[model samples]
Target chain A: MIRFDKISWSAGSFALEEVSFAVPAGSYAVLMGRSGSGKTSLLEILCGLRTPSSGSLWIGDNEITSLSPGERGIGYVPQDGALFPTMTVRENIGFAQRIRGEPAAATKATVGSLAERLGIGAVLDRRPQNLSGGERQRVALGRALASRPQVLVLDEPLSALDEELREGLARLLKDIQRDLKLTTLHVTHHRQEAAQLADHVLRLENGAVVRESGPPQNG
Target chain B: MTLRGSRWFWGLLAGITGAYLAFILAMLAATAVYSAPSDLWKALQSREIQHSIWLSLCTCTVTALLSLFIAIPSGYVLSRATFPGKSWVQAALDIPIVLPPMVMGLALLILFQTWFGRLLEKAVALTYTVNGVVLAQLVIGAAFAIRTMHGTFDHLSARPEEVAMTLGCSRARAAWLVTLPAARRGIFAAGTVAWARSMGEFGPILVFAGATRMKTEVLPTTVWLELSVGNLEAAVAVSLLMVVFAMIILVAVRRVGERV
Candidate 1:
C-alpha cells in the first residue's frame, strides 16, 4: 500500500494543502488533474523528489518521510524517462543491482532477463540517445523494476507518445502490473487513460483530493 | 555582378572576418619581421629566455589546476543551490575578472602585509617567490574558470541525477556516476580558459611577484625586461614565442574535444 497522510506543501505561489489519499497494494491508482493543478507536485512528494511540509509518506507499512530519496523504496519514472546518458541500456537497467554491490554475473543476468521482458533486449548495448520514444520508456520501466521497489510512481509516462504507441504501452503497463502485483500511482490528466488503467481514481482540483472507485463521471 | 539578400549577407560576413584575420596576421608579421632570424634564434637559445619559458609553463599549469580545485565545487553550488546572499556571492566571483590585474596584484601585496596574511606567509612565502607567481595568476585564472564551470553546470539538466537517486544511488554517488561524466566537456573547457588566461597574465605577476632575474621571471616579464633595456628584438621575439604557445594550446584544446 502507498499512502500520503495530511500532506501539505507550498512552493512559491502554488500549494497542495493537507491532501490525504491511499492506493491499495496490487492495484493501480490513477491521479487525475489538469495542468497547473498540483499533480506533478503531489507526484514529486510521493517519489521523494519533494518533501511535504506537514505529512508522512508510507510505503507498505514503512513511514518513509525521514528517509533520503535513495532509501525511500520508490521506483520513479519521470515524464521523459530521464535515462542516464553516460550508460548503455543494460547498465541503466542494472544500475540498482550494481549500486547495491550485487555480483556482476547476477546483475548481468537480471539485466538480460529484464531487457527481454521489456522487449528491449536488442538495444541493451545502446545508449538512450539512440532509442525511440517507446524503447526509451521500456528501458526506463526496466530500470525502475530492477530494484523491486515497494511502490511505483510514474509521472506522465505515456504522455510523450503518439496515439497508437500510447495504447500499446498502456497495455504493456497493465500486463506488467498484473504480473508483478506491483502497487502503483500513475499521474495523468487524460480521462480516457484513467478509465483504461485505474482500479481506483483520485482527482485533484484547486489542491484538494477527491476519491472515486472507478472512472470519473463527466465534470 | 549581382547579389541577392543571402549572397550579400554571406559576402559582408566573410569580408568582416577576413579583415579581422588580416589585421591579426599583420600584427604577427610585424613581430616576425622586426628581428633578424639569427637574433630570434639567439633569444630562444638564451639561458634567461629558456628559464622564463619553463617557469611560465610550470606556473600556468599549476595555477590552472588549482583554479579547478576552487572552481568545481564553487561552480556546482552556485549553479545548483539557492541560498541567502547567493547573488552577492556570485558577484564576488567576478571581482578578480573585472578589477584591473595591477589592482589585484596590489591587493595581494597589501594582503600579505596583514596579520593573517603574515601568519599564512610563515607557512609558505607568496610575496615575491615562484609561489607568488602562481598566486597572482590564480586570482585571475580561477575567476574565468569558475564562470565557465558555472555556465556548463547550468546548461546540463539535473533530471538524470535525480533518476539515479531513485535507483538506489545516494546523492553524492549520483553526482559522481552521472552528473560529472556529463560535465566532462565543460570541465575541460573551464581548465582551458584558466590556462589561457594564466598564460597571458602579466600585470599581477609584475606587481606582486617582481621580475627578479632567473627567480620569478616569466614570459611576460621577459618582454617587460627586454623592453626596459631597449632590447626591442628580444622583446618582439618573446612576443612571437607567446603566440606560438597560444597556437599549441588552441590545437590541444581542439584535440581534447575530438578525442575525449
Candidate 2:
C-alpha cells in the first residue's frame, strides 16, 4: 500500500496544498491530471527524489518519508527510462541486484528471465540508445521489477508510443500488475490509458485529489 | 533569415578559416625548413638536448596526472552544487589561467620564500629544482583541466546518477560506477589538453625554475639557454623538435582517446 497524508509542497510559485490520497494494496491506481498540475512533483516526492514540505508517506505500513530513495523499496520508472548509458540492457536490468551484492549467478538469472518475460531477450546485449521506444520502455519496466519492490511508480510509461503500441503495452502492464499484485500509482494524462489499466482512478486537480472512482463497468 | 541564403556569406566564413589555417601552417613550416634533417638529427644526439627532452616528458606526465586528480572533484563540485559565493569561487579558480605567465612565475618565486613554502621546500625542493618545473606547469595546466572538467560535468545529465540512486546505490557509488565511466571521453580530452599545455609552457618555467644544465632545464629552458649562448642553429633545431614531438603526441592521443 502507498499512502500520502496532508502532503504540501512549494516549488517556485506553485503549491501542492494539503493533498491526501491512498493506493490500496494489490491494486493499480491511476492519478490523472493536466500538464503542470503537480502530478510529476507528487510522483517525485513519493519516489524520494524530492521532499514535501509537510507530509507523511507510507509504503506497506512503514513510514518512509524520512528515508533515502534507495531505502524506500519503491521502484520508479521515469518518463524517459533514464537507463545508465554506459551499460547494456542486460546490465541495466540487473543493476539493482548487482549493486546489492547478490550472487552473480542469481543476478544473471534475473536478467535473463526478465529479458525473456519482457520480450526483449534479443536486445539484451544492445545499448539503450539502439532500442526502439517500446523496447526501451519494457527494459525500464524490467529494471524496476528486478528489484521486486512492494510499490511501483510510473510516470507517462506509454506517452511516447503509437496508438497500437500503446494499447499493446497497456494490456501487458495490466497483466504484470495483476501477476505481481503490487500496489501501483501510475501518473498519466490519457483518460483511455487510465480506464484501460486502473482498477481505481484518482483525479488530481488544483493540487489536490478532487475525485476518486472505479473503472467503468464496461472497462 | 538564413545565414546560408547568400553564397558569399558561406565563402566569407570559409575564407577567414582557410587563411588562419594557412598562416599557422606556414609558421610551423618555416621552423621545419630552417634546419635540414641532418642538423636536426645531430642536435637530437646532443647530451643537453637528450636531458631536456627527458626532463620535459617526465614533468609533463606528472603534471597531467596531478591535474586530473585535482580536476575531477573540483569540476564535480563546481558543476553540481550551489553555494553562497559560487561565482566568486569560479573566478578564483580562473586566476591561474588569466595571470600572465611571467606574473605567475614571479608569484611562485615569491611564494617559495614564505613560511609555508619554506616548510614545503624542506620536504621537497621546488624553487629552481626539477620538481619546480612541474609546479610551474601545474599552476596553469590544472586550471585548464578544471575548466574542462567543469564544462564536461555540466554537459552530462544527472538523470543516470539519479536512476542509480533509485536502484539502491549511494550517490558516491553511482558517480563512480555510472557518471565517471560515462565521462571517459571528457577525461581523455582534458588530460590531453593539459599535457599539451604543459609542453608549451615557457615563460613561467624561466622565472621560477632557472635554466641549469642537466639539472632543472626542460625543453623550453633549453631553448632559452641555447638562444642565450647565440647558438641559433641549436635553438631553432630544438624549437622544431618541440613542435614535431608535440604534433606526434597530440595525434596519437587523439587516436587513443577516440578508441577509448
Candidate 3:
C-alpha cells in the first residue's frame, strides 16, 4: 500500500496543498490531471525524486518520506522511456544488477527473464535509439522491473503512441500489472485510459486531488 | 536579393578561404622540398634534433594526460552544478585562453621566484627544468580540455544519471557507470585537442622552461634555435616535422569530432 498524508509542496508560483490519498496493496491507481496540475510533481515526490514541502509518505509498513528512491524500493519509468541511449536493451535491463556488482551470469539471467516477460527478448541486442516507440517503452519497462520493486510508477508511458498502439500496450500493461500484483501508480491525462486500466482513479486539479473513484468495471 | 546574394557569391567567398588554406599548405610543402632528401635526413639524425623531438613527445603526452585527470571532474561540476560564484569560477577558467602566452610564462616564472616556489625549489627545482616545460604546456592545454568537456556534459541530459540513482547507484557511482560511458566521445575529443595544443605550445615554455639545448629544446624551440644559428635548412626541416605532426592530430580530431 502507498499512502500520502497531508502532502504539500510549493515552488515559485506553484503549490500543491494537503494532497492526501492511498492505493491499496496490489491495486493499480491512475492519477489524472491537466497540464501544470502537479500530477507529475506528486508522482515525483512519491518516488523520492522530489521532497514534499511538508508531509509524510508510507509504502506498506515503511515510512518512505525519509528514504532515498533506491532505498524506497520503487521502480520508476519516466516519460519518453529515458532509456540509456548508449546501452543495449539487455545492458539497460541489467544496469541495476551490474551497478550492485552482481555476477555476470546472474545479471544475464535476470535480464533474460525480464526481457522474456516484457516480450522484448528479440530486441535485447539493440540500442534505445534503434527501438520503436512501443519497443522503447517495453525496454524501459523491462529495465524498471529488473530490480523487482514493490511499487511501479509510470509517467504517461503510452501518451506518445498511436491510438492502435496505445490500446494494445494498455491491455498488455493491465495484464502485466495483474500478473505481478504490483502496487502501481500510473499518471495520464486520458480518462479513457483510466476507465480501461485503473482499479482506482484520482484526479488532480491545481495541485490537489479533487476526485477519487472505485475500480472500473471488468472488460 | 539576400545579403549573401546568390549561390555564386557564397561559392566565391568559400573558394577564396579554401585557396588561402591551400596556399599555406603548398608553401610548407615547397619549403620542405627546397632542401634535398640527404639534407633532411642529415638534419633528422642530429642528436639535438632527435632529443628535441623525443622531449616534445614525452612532455606533451604527460601534460595532456594530467590535464584530463583534472578536466573530467572540473568540467562535470562546472557544467552540472549550480553554486555561489559559478560565474566567477567560469571567468577564472577562461584566463588561460585569453591571457597572452608570454604573460602567462612570466607569471609562472614570477611564481617560482616567490617564497612558496623557493620552498618548493629546495626539494625539487622547477624553473629551467624539463618539468617546467610540462607545467607550461598543462596551463593552456587543461584550460582548452576543460572547456570542451564542460560543453560536452552540458549537452548531455541529467535524466540518465537521475535514472541510475533511482536504480540504487549513488550519485558518484551513477556518474561513473552511466554518464562517463555515455561521454566517451567527448572525452576522446577533449584529450586529442589538449594533446595537440600541448605539442604546439611554445611561448610559455620558452620563458619559463628556457631553451637549454638537450634539456628544454622542444620541436618549436628547436626551430627557433636553428633560425638564430642561421641554419635555414634545419629550421625548415623542424617546421616540416611540426606540420606533419599537426596534420596527423587534426585528422584524428576530425574523426573523433564526427563520432561525438
- Per-prediction TM-score, please? 0.95, 0.93, 0.90
Q: Candidate 3: which docking quality band?
A: medium
Cα error, residue B19 of model 3, in Å, equals 4.1
Superposition error at B157 for model 3 (Å) = 1.7
Candidate 2: Cα lDDT at B22: 100
Q: Please tell me the interface RMSD, in Å, for model 1.
A: 1.0
In candidate 1, what are the lDDT values of residues B1-260, reduced to their tens digit? 45588899999999999999999999899888988999988878889999999999999999999999999888999998879999999999999999999999999999998999999999998989999999999999999999999998899888888888888888789888998888888888888899989989999999999999899999999999999999888898899999999998899889996665
| All candidates: interface RMSD | 1.0, 0.9, 1.2
lDDT of 2 at A140: 92
How far residue B256's Cα lies from its native spot in candidate 3, in Å, is 5.2
Give the per-residue lDDT digits (tens) of candidate 3, residues A83-124.
898899999999988877899999999988888877888999
Stretches of candidate 2 off by over 4 Å are A11-18, A215-219, B1-6
* Candidate scoring better on TM-score of 1 and 2: 1
Model 1 off-target regions past 4 Å? A212-219, B1-3
Between candidates 1 and 3, which one is better according to TM-score?
1
Give all candidates' CA lDDT scores: 0.89, 0.89, 0.88
lDDT (tens digit, per residue) of candidate 2 on B1-260? 57556777889899999999999999988888888788878888999889999999999999999999999999999998878899999999999899998899999999988999899999998998888999999999999999999999999888778778888988899899999988888888888778989998988898899888998888888888888998877888889878887888789777987887
Better of 2 and 3 by TM-score: 2
Q: Please report the candidate that would top DockQ against the real structure.
A: 1
For A84-174, candidate 2 gives per-residue lDDT tens digits of: 8889999999999999999999999999988888899999999988999999999999999999888989999999999999999889889
Docking class of 1: medium
In terms of TM-score, the best-performing candidate is: 1
